[model samples]
Target: MSSVETVKNSPWQQGARDALPLLGGYIPVAISFGLIAVQSGFSALETVLISALIYAGASQFLFIAMVASGAPLWLVLVMTLLINARHLVYGPNIAPYLSNSRWWPVLMHGLTDQIFALAHTRLPQLEEKDRMGWYISAALIAWLSWIVGTAVGAVAGAEITSRWPLLGEVMPFALPALFLVLLAPRFTSVQWTLTMLVSIVAALVLKLMGMTNSAIPLAALCGVSLFYLLQAKLKAEGEIHG
Candidate 1:
Protein backbone atom coordinates (compact mmCIF):
# COMPACT_ATOMS: atom_id res chain seq x y z
CA MET A 1 0.00 0.00 0.00
CA SER A 2 1.05 3.58 -0.60
CA SER A 3 2.02 5.93 2.22
CA VAL A 4 -1.35 7.58 1.69
CA GLU A 5 -3.12 4.33 2.43
CA THR A 6 -1.02 3.83 5.52
CA VAL A 7 -1.96 7.29 6.77
CA LYS A 8 -5.62 6.50 6.18
CA ASN A 9 -5.43 3.19 8.02
CA SER A 10 -3.62 4.34 11.11
CA PRO A 11 -6.84 5.46 12.78
CA TRP A 12 -8.23 1.97 12.41
CA GLN A 13 -5.39 0.63 14.52
CA GLN A 14 -5.88 3.37 17.07
CA GLY A 15 -9.58 2.55 17.30
CA ALA A 16 -8.84 -1.11 17.94
CA ARG A 17 -6.51 -0.25 20.77
CA ASP A 18 -9.03 2.13 22.32
CA ALA A 19 -11.70 -0.54 22.32
CA LEU A 20 -9.58 -3.18 24.01
CA PRO A 21 -11.31 -2.71 27.36
CA LEU A 22 -14.68 -3.36 25.79
CA LEU A 23 -13.49 -6.71 24.49
CA GLY A 24 -12.87 -7.88 28.02
CA GLY A 25 -16.47 -7.04 28.91
CA TYR A 26 -17.96 -8.54 25.75
CA ILE A 27 -16.40 -11.99 25.89
CA PRO A 28 -18.23 -13.39 28.90
CA VAL A 29 -21.61 -12.05 27.84
CA ALA A 30 -21.20 -13.39 24.31
CA ILE A 31 -20.01 -16.71 25.60
CA SER A 32 -23.16 -16.84 27.69
CA PHE A 33 -25.27 -16.22 24.59
CA GLY A 34 -23.61 -19.07 22.78
CA LEU A 35 -23.91 -21.42 25.70
CA ILE A 36 -27.58 -20.63 26.21
CA ALA A 37 -28.30 -20.81 22.50
CA VAL A 38 -26.91 -24.30 22.31
CA GLN A 39 -28.63 -25.31 25.50
CA SER A 40 -31.89 -24.06 24.01
CA GLY A 41 -31.51 -26.71 21.26
CA PHE A 42 -29.85 -24.55 18.63
CA SER A 43 -27.09 -26.18 16.71
CA ALA A 44 -23.66 -24.60 17.07
CA LEU A 45 -24.04 -23.27 13.53
CA GLU A 46 -27.41 -21.72 14.29
CA THR A 47 -26.03 -20.05 17.40
CA VAL A 48 -23.14 -18.49 15.50
CA LEU A 49 -25.42 -17.40 12.65
CA ILE A 50 -27.72 -15.59 15.07
CA SER A 51 -24.78 -13.80 16.65
CA ALA A 52 -23.32 -12.91 13.24
CA LEU A 53 -26.53 -11.78 11.60
CA ILE A 54 -28.67 -10.26 14.34
CA TYR A 55 -25.76 -8.94 16.39
CA ALA A 56 -27.92 -7.42 19.14
CA GLY A 57 -26.78 -8.88 22.42
CA ALA A 58 -29.86 -8.18 24.55
CA SER A 59 -32.34 -8.95 21.79
CA GLN A 60 -30.51 -12.15 20.94
CA PHE A 61 -30.93 -13.38 24.46
CA LEU A 62 -34.63 -12.52 24.41
CA PHE A 63 -34.99 -14.06 20.94
CA ILE A 64 -33.61 -17.44 21.94
CA ALA A 65 -35.63 -17.44 25.13
CA MET A 66 -38.89 -16.63 23.41
CA VAL A 67 -38.22 -19.09 20.59
CA ALA A 68 -37.40 -21.84 23.04
CA SER A 69 -40.73 -21.26 24.69
CA GLY A 70 -42.59 -21.59 21.37
CA ALA A 71 -43.58 -17.97 20.85
CA PRO A 72 -45.08 -17.33 17.41
CA LEU A 73 -42.71 -16.21 14.69
CA TRP A 74 -44.40 -12.85 14.24
CA LEU A 75 -44.24 -12.19 17.96
CA VAL A 76 -40.59 -13.12 17.99
CA LEU A 77 -39.85 -10.69 15.17
CA VAL A 78 -41.82 -7.90 16.80
CA MET A 79 -40.23 -8.43 20.19
CA THR A 80 -36.73 -8.44 18.78
CA LEU A 81 -37.43 -5.26 16.85
CA LEU A 82 -38.95 -3.66 19.91
CA ILE A 83 -35.98 -4.53 22.05
CA ASN A 84 -33.65 -2.94 19.51
CA ALA A 85 -35.63 0.20 18.72
CA ARG A 86 -33.21 2.07 20.96
CA HIS A 87 -30.66 1.83 18.15
CA LEU A 88 -32.63 4.42 16.25
CA VAL A 89 -31.48 6.94 18.83
CA TYR A 90 -27.87 5.86 18.46
CA GLY A 91 -27.90 6.06 14.65
CA PRO A 92 -28.69 9.77 14.33
CA ASN A 93 -26.13 10.59 16.98
CA ILE A 94 -23.36 8.96 14.93
CA ALA A 95 -24.49 9.88 11.43
CA PRO A 96 -22.72 13.23 11.24
CA TYR A 97 -19.42 11.55 12.05
CA LEU A 98 -19.65 8.81 9.42
CA SER A 99 -17.27 10.53 6.95
CA ASN A 100 -19.64 9.65 4.09
CA SER A 101 -17.55 6.61 3.30
CA ARG A 102 -18.79 3.99 0.85
CA TRP A 103 -18.23 1.31 3.48
CA TRP A 104 -20.63 2.80 6.03
CA PRO A 105 -23.26 0.15 5.48
CA VAL A 106 -20.84 -2.58 6.47
CA LEU A 107 -19.69 -0.67 9.51
CA MET A 108 -23.21 0.21 10.56
CA HIS A 109 -24.25 -3.40 10.38
CA GLY A 110 -22.20 -4.16 13.48
CA LEU A 111 -23.02 -1.10 15.56
CA THR A 112 -23.89 -2.57 18.95
CA ASP A 113 -24.64 -0.90 22.27
CA GLN A 114 -21.02 -0.89 23.37
CA ILE A 115 -19.85 0.40 20.00
CA PHE A 116 -22.34 3.24 20.08
CA ALA A 117 -21.46 4.15 23.67
CA LEU A 118 -17.78 4.37 22.86
CA ALA A 119 -18.25 6.18 19.57
CA HIS A 120 -20.56 8.81 20.97
CA THR A 121 -18.13 9.66 23.77
CA ARG A 122 -14.82 9.35 21.93
CA LEU A 123 -15.39 10.30 18.29
CA PRO A 124 -15.41 14.04 18.89
CA GLN A 125 -11.89 13.77 20.30
CA LEU A 126 -10.70 12.16 17.07
CA GLU A 127 -9.50 14.12 14.07
CA GLU A 128 -12.41 14.71 11.69
CA LYS A 129 -10.69 12.71 8.95
CA ASP A 130 -10.01 9.78 11.25
CA ARG A 131 -13.41 9.46 12.91
CA MET A 132 -14.85 6.97 10.45
CA GLY A 133 -11.79 4.78 10.47
CA TRP A 134 -11.71 4.77 14.25
CA TYR A 135 -15.41 4.03 14.58
CA ILE A 136 -15.27 1.19 12.07
CA SER A 137 -12.14 -0.30 13.59
CA ALA A 138 -13.50 -0.19 17.11
CA ALA A 139 -16.80 -1.68 16.00
CA LEU A 140 -15.07 -4.42 14.04
CA ILE A 141 -12.94 -5.40 17.01
CA ALA A 142 -16.04 -5.70 19.19
CA TRP A 143 -17.87 -7.67 16.48
CA LEU A 144 -15.06 -10.15 16.03
CA SER A 145 -14.67 -10.64 19.74
CA TRP A 146 -18.37 -11.47 20.10
CA ILE A 147 -18.28 -13.92 17.22
CA VAL A 148 -15.16 -15.65 18.51
CA GLY A 149 -16.51 -15.84 22.02
CA THR A 150 -19.76 -17.32 20.77
CA ALA A 151 -17.91 -19.96 18.80
CA VAL A 152 -15.90 -20.96 21.83
CA GLY A 153 -19.00 -21.11 24.01
CA ALA A 154 -20.94 -23.12 21.46
CA VAL A 155 -18.14 -25.64 21.14
CA ALA A 156 -17.76 -26.07 24.89
CA GLY A 157 -21.43 -25.85 25.87
CA ALA A 158 -22.26 -29.47 25.42
CA GLU A 159 -19.45 -30.79 27.54
CA ILE A 160 -20.14 -28.34 30.32
CA THR A 161 -23.85 -29.10 30.36
CA SER A 162 -23.22 -32.81 30.33
CA ARG A 163 -20.99 -32.54 33.34
CA TRP A 164 -22.96 -29.97 35.30
CA PRO A 165 -26.60 -29.44 34.45
CA LEU A 166 -27.19 -26.72 37.05
CA LEU A 167 -24.48 -24.57 35.59
CA GLY A 168 -26.16 -24.76 32.22
CA GLU A 169 -29.41 -23.58 33.79
CA VAL A 170 -27.61 -20.54 35.13
CA MET A 171 -26.30 -19.33 31.77
CA PRO A 172 -29.39 -17.42 30.71
CA PHE A 173 -29.06 -15.05 33.67
CA ALA A 174 -25.80 -13.76 32.30
CA LEU A 175 -27.47 -11.17 30.10
CA PRO A 176 -29.31 -9.61 33.03
CA ALA A 177 -26.23 -9.80 35.19
CA LEU A 178 -24.20 -8.17 32.52
CA PHE A 179 -26.67 -5.33 32.22
CA LEU A 180 -26.60 -4.81 35.98
CA VAL A 181 -22.84 -4.66 35.90
CA LEU A 182 -22.94 -2.08 33.13
CA LEU A 183 -25.63 -0.01 34.80
CA ALA A 184 -24.23 -0.04 38.30
CA PRO A 185 -21.80 2.79 37.76
CA ARG A 186 -24.38 4.96 36.03
CA PHE A 187 -26.91 4.72 38.86
CA THR A 188 -25.12 7.53 40.63
CA SER A 189 -27.06 9.88 38.39
CA VAL A 190 -30.62 10.66 39.45
CA GLN A 191 -31.87 10.86 35.89
CA TRP A 192 -30.60 7.43 35.05
CA THR A 193 -32.05 5.99 38.21
CA LEU A 194 -35.43 7.51 37.46
CA THR A 195 -35.35 6.19 33.92
CA MET A 196 -34.60 2.69 35.11
CA LEU A 197 -37.34 2.73 37.68
CA VAL A 198 -39.87 4.13 35.26
CA SER A 199 -39.04 1.60 32.64
CA ILE A 200 -39.33 -1.31 35.02
CA VAL A 201 -42.64 -0.19 36.42
CA ALA A 202 -44.07 0.59 33.04
CA ALA A 203 -43.03 -2.74 31.63
CA LEU A 204 -44.49 -4.61 34.56
CA VAL A 205 -47.77 -2.69 34.43
CA LEU A 206 -48.08 -3.17 30.70
CA LYS A 207 -47.37 -6.85 31.05
CA LEU A 208 -50.03 -7.13 33.72
CA MET A 209 -52.44 -5.33 31.42
CA GLY A 210 -52.11 -8.17 28.89
CA MET A 211 -49.76 -6.35 26.54
CA THR A 212 -47.30 -9.27 26.49
CA ASN A 213 -44.53 -8.75 23.94
CA SER A 214 -45.52 -5.16 23.31
CA ALA A 215 -44.85 -4.23 26.90
CA ILE A 216 -41.16 -3.62 26.51
CA PRO A 217 -41.43 -1.18 23.61
CA LEU A 218 -44.31 0.69 25.14
CA ALA A 219 -42.57 0.83 28.47
CA ALA A 220 -39.35 2.09 26.98
CA LEU A 221 -41.24 4.80 25.17
CA CYS A 222 -42.94 5.88 28.36
CA GLY A 223 -39.70 5.92 30.32
CA VAL A 224 -37.85 8.00 27.76
CA SER A 225 -40.73 10.42 27.47
CA LEU A 226 -40.91 10.82 31.21
CA PHE A 227 -37.19 11.36 31.48
CA TYR A 228 -37.24 14.21 28.96
CA LEU A 229 -40.21 15.76 30.65
CA LEU A 230 -38.52 15.65 33.99
CA GLN A 231 -35.42 17.21 32.58
CA ALA A 232 -37.42 19.99 30.98
CA LYS A 233 -39.33 20.59 34.15
CA LEU A 234 -36.15 20.82 36.15
CA LYS A 235 -34.65 23.26 33.74
CA ALA A 236 -37.72 25.47 33.81
CA GLU A 237 -37.82 25.52 37.61
CA GLY A 238 -34.11 26.35 37.77
CA GLU A 239 -34.59 29.26 35.37
CA ILE A 240 -37.52 30.57 37.40
CA HIS A 241 -35.57 30.37 40.65
CA GLY A 242 -32.50 31.95 39.14
Candidate 2:
Protein backbone atom coordinates (compact mmCIF):
# COMPACT_ATOMS: atom_id res chain seq x y z
CA MET A 1 0.00 0.00 0.00
CA SER A 2 1.01 3.66 -0.43
CA SER A 3 2.57 5.67 2.39
CA VAL A 4 -0.51 7.93 2.73
CA GLU A 5 -2.70 4.85 2.99
CA THR A 6 -0.36 3.31 5.50
CA VAL A 7 -0.33 6.43 7.64
CA LYS A 8 -4.07 7.01 7.35
CA ASN A 9 -4.75 3.42 8.35
CA SER A 10 -2.84 3.99 11.54
CA PRO A 11 -5.22 6.57 12.92
CA TRP A 12 -3.22 7.01 16.10
CA GLN A 13 -0.15 8.26 14.29
CA GLN A 14 -2.15 10.53 12.02
CA GLY A 15 -4.15 11.92 14.90
CA ALA A 16 -1.11 12.61 17.05
CA ARG A 17 0.43 14.60 14.24
CA ASP A 18 -2.82 16.45 13.53
CA ALA A 19 -3.21 17.24 17.21
CA LEU A 20 0.15 19.00 17.48
CA PRO A 21 -1.11 22.35 16.22
CA LEU A 22 -3.79 22.39 18.88
CA LEU A 23 -1.20 21.93 21.61
CA GLY A 24 0.21 25.47 21.18
CA GLY A 25 -3.22 26.54 22.43
CA TYR A 26 -4.22 23.68 24.72
CA ILE A 27 -1.09 23.22 26.83
CA PRO A 28 -0.96 26.78 28.16
CA VAL A 29 -4.66 26.84 29.08
CA ALA A 30 -4.52 23.44 30.70
CA ILE A 31 -1.51 24.56 32.63
CA SER A 32 -3.32 27.75 33.59
CA PHE A 33 -6.28 25.72 34.83
CA GLY A 34 -4.05 23.73 37.11
CA LEU A 35 -2.28 26.84 38.27
CA ILE A 36 -5.49 28.71 38.90
CA ALA A 37 -7.11 25.81 40.70
CA VAL A 38 -4.26 25.41 43.12
CA GLN A 39 -3.99 29.13 43.76
CA SER A 40 -7.70 29.21 44.42
CA GLY A 41 -7.10 26.89 47.37
CA PHE A 42 -7.51 23.50 45.78
CA SER A 43 -5.15 20.78 46.84
CA ALA A 44 -2.91 19.58 44.03
CA LEU A 45 -4.77 16.26 44.04
CA GLU A 46 -8.13 17.98 43.92
CA THR A 47 -6.95 20.27 41.16
CA VAL A 48 -5.66 17.40 39.06
CA LEU A 49 -8.82 15.43 39.74
CA ILE A 50 -10.94 18.34 38.54
CA SER A 51 -9.09 18.44 35.20
CA ALA A 52 -9.18 14.65 34.89
CA LEU A 53 -12.87 14.38 35.62
CA ILE A 54 -14.34 17.63 34.29
CA TYR A 55 -11.99 17.85 31.30
CA ALA A 56 -13.44 21.22 30.38
CA GLY A 57 -11.21 24.25 30.81
CA ALA A 58 -13.89 26.94 31.14
CA SER A 59 -16.17 24.93 33.40
CA GLN A 60 -13.24 23.81 35.49
CA PHE A 61 -12.32 27.43 36.12
CA LEU A 62 -15.92 28.24 36.99
CA PHE A 63 -16.03 25.28 39.33
CA ILE A 64 -12.88 26.40 41.06
CA ALA A 65 -14.29 29.89 41.48
CA MET A 66 -17.54 28.62 42.94
CA VAL A 67 -15.91 26.10 45.23
CA ALA A 68 -13.35 28.60 46.47
CA SER A 69 -16.12 31.04 47.26
CA GLY A 70 -18.10 28.29 48.98
CA ALA A 71 -21.07 28.69 46.71
CA PRO A 72 -24.06 26.47 47.36
CA LEU A 73 -24.00 22.95 45.95
CA TRP A 74 -27.30 23.50 44.20
CA LEU A 75 -26.00 26.60 42.46
CA VAL A 76 -22.83 24.81 41.40
CA LEU A 77 -24.89 21.94 39.99
CA VAL A 78 -27.15 24.26 38.07
CA MET A 79 -24.28 26.29 36.71
CA THR A 80 -22.24 23.27 35.70
CA LEU A 81 -25.14 21.67 33.84
CA LEU A 82 -26.06 24.93 32.16
CA ILE A 83 -22.50 25.76 31.16
CA ASN A 84 -22.08 22.34 29.59
CA ALA A 85 -25.40 22.44 27.77
CA ARG A 86 -23.61 23.55 24.58
CA HIS A 87 -22.23 20.01 24.37
CA LEU A 88 -25.76 18.82 23.76
CA VAL A 89 -25.70 20.83 20.54
CA TYR A 90 -22.28 19.48 19.62
CA GLY A 91 -23.06 15.78 20.05
CA PRO A 92 -25.92 15.51 17.57
CA ASN A 93 -23.95 17.32 14.88
CA ILE A 94 -21.06 14.87 15.31
CA ALA A 95 -23.11 11.70 15.75
CA PRO A 96 -23.81 11.16 12.06
CA TYR A 97 -20.12 11.21 11.19
CA LEU A 98 -19.03 8.75 13.84
CA SER A 99 -18.70 5.02 13.27
CA ASN A 100 -20.88 2.48 14.98
CA SER A 101 -18.00 1.11 16.95
CA ARG A 102 -18.79 -0.15 20.43
CA TRP A 103 -16.07 2.21 21.60
CA TRP A 104 -18.03 5.16 20.26
CA PRO A 105 -19.12 6.15 23.73
CA VAL A 106 -15.57 6.07 24.99
CA LEU A 107 -14.39 8.04 21.99
CA MET A 108 -17.04 10.65 22.61
CA HIS A 109 -15.39 11.40 25.93
CA GLY A 110 -12.77 13.43 24.05
CA LEU A 111 -15.31 15.70 22.42
CA THR A 112 -14.35 19.16 23.61
CA ASP A 113 -15.28 22.42 21.91
CA GLN A 114 -11.91 22.69 20.19
CA ILE A 115 -11.91 19.04 19.16
CA PHE A 116 -15.41 19.36 17.76
CA ALA A 117 -14.35 22.43 15.83
CA LEU A 118 -11.40 20.50 14.48
CA ALA A 119 -13.47 17.45 13.65
CA HIS A 120 -16.19 19.23 11.73
CA THR A 121 -13.72 21.35 9.85
CA ARG A 122 -11.10 18.68 9.16
CA LEU A 123 -12.86 15.31 9.23
CA PRO A 124 -14.78 15.97 6.01
CA GLN A 125 -11.51 15.71 4.11
CA LEU A 126 -10.91 12.13 5.17
CA GLU A 127 -12.45 8.93 3.83
CA GLU A 128 -15.52 8.02 5.85
CA LYS A 129 -14.10 4.85 7.35
CA ASP A 130 -10.92 6.61 8.37
CA ARG A 131 -12.63 9.61 9.93
CA MET A 132 -13.60 7.95 13.19
CA GLY A 133 -10.11 6.61 13.80
CA TRP A 134 -8.56 9.98 13.12
CA TYR A 135 -11.09 11.75 15.32
CA ILE A 136 -10.57 9.30 18.19
CA SER A 137 -6.81 9.62 17.88
CA ALA A 138 -6.98 13.41 17.86
CA ALA A 139 -9.31 13.42 20.81
CA LEU A 140 -7.14 11.08 22.87
CA ILE A 141 -4.06 13.19 22.23
CA ALA A 142 -5.81 16.39 23.24
CA TRP A 143 -7.21 14.78 26.37
CA LEU A 144 -3.86 13.39 27.39
CA SER A 145 -2.17 16.74 26.83
CA TRP A 146 -4.69 18.47 29.00
CA ILE A 147 -4.24 15.95 31.78
CA VAL A 148 -0.48 16.17 31.61
CA GLY A 149 -0.48 19.95 31.53
CA THR A 150 -2.82 20.01 34.49
CA ALA A 151 -0.59 17.60 36.39
CA VAL A 152 2.43 19.82 35.75
CA GLY A 153 0.60 22.94 36.87
CA ALA A 154 -0.89 21.27 39.91
CA VAL A 155 2.51 20.16 41.11
CA ALA A 156 4.23 23.47 40.48
CA GLY A 157 1.39 25.98 40.59
CA ALA A 158 1.37 26.82 44.25
CA GLU A 159 5.09 27.30 44.46
CA ILE A 160 5.12 29.40 41.33
CA THR A 161 2.27 31.49 42.63
CA SER A 162 4.06 32.08 45.90
CA ARG A 163 7.21 33.07 44.09
CA TRP A 164 5.48 35.35 41.63
CA PRO A 165 2.12 36.47 42.90
CA LEU A 166 1.46 38.42 39.72
CA LEU A 167 1.59 35.26 37.68
CA GLY A 168 -1.02 33.66 39.91
CA GLU A 169 -3.27 36.68 39.51
CA VAL A 170 -2.85 36.38 35.75
CA MET A 171 -3.72 32.69 35.57
CA PRO A 172 -7.44 33.27 35.89
CA PHE A 173 -7.53 35.43 32.77
CA ALA A 174 -5.99 32.78 30.53
CA LEU A 175 -9.21 30.88 29.79
CA PRO A 176 -11.17 33.99 28.91
CA ALA A 177 -8.33 35.19 26.72
CA LEU A 178 -8.27 31.85 24.97
CA PHE A 179 -12.01 32.03 24.36
CA LEU A 180 -11.72 35.51 22.94
CA VAL A 181 -9.06 34.27 20.54
CA LEU A 182 -11.34 31.47 19.43
CA LEU A 183 -14.32 33.78 19.01
CA ALA A 184 -12.42 36.38 17.01
CA PRO A 185 -12.76 34.50 13.73
CA ARG A 186 -16.55 34.34 13.94
CA PHE A 187 -17.02 38.05 14.56
CA THR A 188 -17.00 38.97 10.87
CA SER A 189 -20.50 37.64 10.15
CA VAL A 190 -23.61 39.69 10.88
CA GLN A 191 -25.27 36.75 12.57
CA TRP A 192 -22.26 36.17 14.80
CA THR A 193 -22.00 39.89 15.48
CA LEU A 194 -25.56 40.10 16.69
CA THR A 195 -25.17 36.98 18.73
CA MET A 196 -22.06 38.34 20.38
CA LEU A 197 -23.76 41.62 21.20
CA VAL A 198 -26.70 39.90 22.77
CA SER A 199 -24.48 37.46 24.63
CA ILE A 200 -22.36 40.24 26.03
CA VAL A 201 -25.43 42.12 27.20
CA ALA A 202 -26.95 39.03 28.74
CA ALA A 203 -23.73 38.14 30.54
CA LEU A 204 -23.36 41.64 31.91
CA VAL A 205 -26.95 41.68 33.06
CA LEU A 206 -26.65 38.31 34.73
CA LYS A 207 -23.44 39.34 36.43
CA LEU A 208 -25.10 42.49 37.71
CA MET A 209 -27.99 40.40 38.98
CA GLY A 210 -25.53 38.29 40.99
CA MET A 211 -25.93 35.20 38.80
CA THR A 212 -22.31 35.14 37.75
CA ASN A 213 -21.91 31.45 37.27
CA SER A 214 -25.14 31.24 35.32
CA ALA A 215 -24.03 33.94 32.90
CA ILE A 216 -21.96 31.88 30.47
CA PRO A 217 -24.60 29.29 29.59
CA LEU A 218 -27.50 31.69 29.74
CA ALA A 219 -25.67 34.08 27.44
CA ALA A 220 -24.78 31.29 25.03
CA LEU A 221 -28.36 30.02 24.94
CA CYS A 222 -29.65 33.50 24.33
CA GLY A 223 -27.13 34.22 21.59
CA VAL A 224 -27.73 30.95 19.72
CA SER A 225 -31.50 31.29 19.88
CA LEU A 226 -31.33 34.88 18.68
CA PHE A 227 -29.06 33.94 15.79
CA TYR A 228 -31.50 31.26 14.62
CA LEU A 229 -34.43 33.60 14.99
CA LEU A 230 -32.72 36.32 12.99
CA GLN A 231 -31.71 33.87 10.30
CA ALA A 232 -35.26 32.53 10.01
CA LYS A 233 -36.67 36.03 9.81
CA LEU A 234 -34.27 37.00 7.03
CA LYS A 235 -35.01 33.80 5.15
CA ALA A 236 -38.75 34.38 5.35
CA GLU A 237 -38.35 38.00 4.24
CA GLY A 238 -36.30 36.87 1.22
CA GLU A 239 -38.93 34.32 0.28
CA ILE A 240 -41.71 36.89 0.43
CA HIS A 241 -39.69 39.42 -1.60
CA GLY A 242 -38.70 36.78 -4.14
- Per-prediction TM-score, please? 0.68, 0.68
Candidate that scores best on lDDT? 1
- Which segments of candidate 1 are over 4 A away from where they belong? 1-9, 158-242
Q: Candidate 2 residues 1-242, lDDT tens each?
A: 11122344466677777666677667767777888887898888888888878888777888889989999988987878777777887778877777778887777778887787666655655767888778878998888888988987788755654676664455546445545554565677888899998998898899999886568668878998999999999999999999
Clashes found in each candidate (C-alpha, N, C closer than 3 A): 0, 0
Tell me the lDDT of model 2 at 164.
67
Candidate 2 local accuracy as lDDT? 0.76
RMSD of each: 7.3, 5.9
Q: Can you write out model 1's per-residue Cα lDDT over 1-242, one digit (the tens) per residue?
A: 11112233378887887667676667767778899998899999999999999998888999999999999999999989987887788878888766777887667887787777667656766678888878878888888888987887898855654776665466546544544544555555787789888887898899899876568668878888988988998899999999
- Local error of candidate 1 at residue 180 (angstroms): 12
- Candidate 1 differs from the real structure by a C-alpha RMSD in angstroms, to one decimal, of 7.3
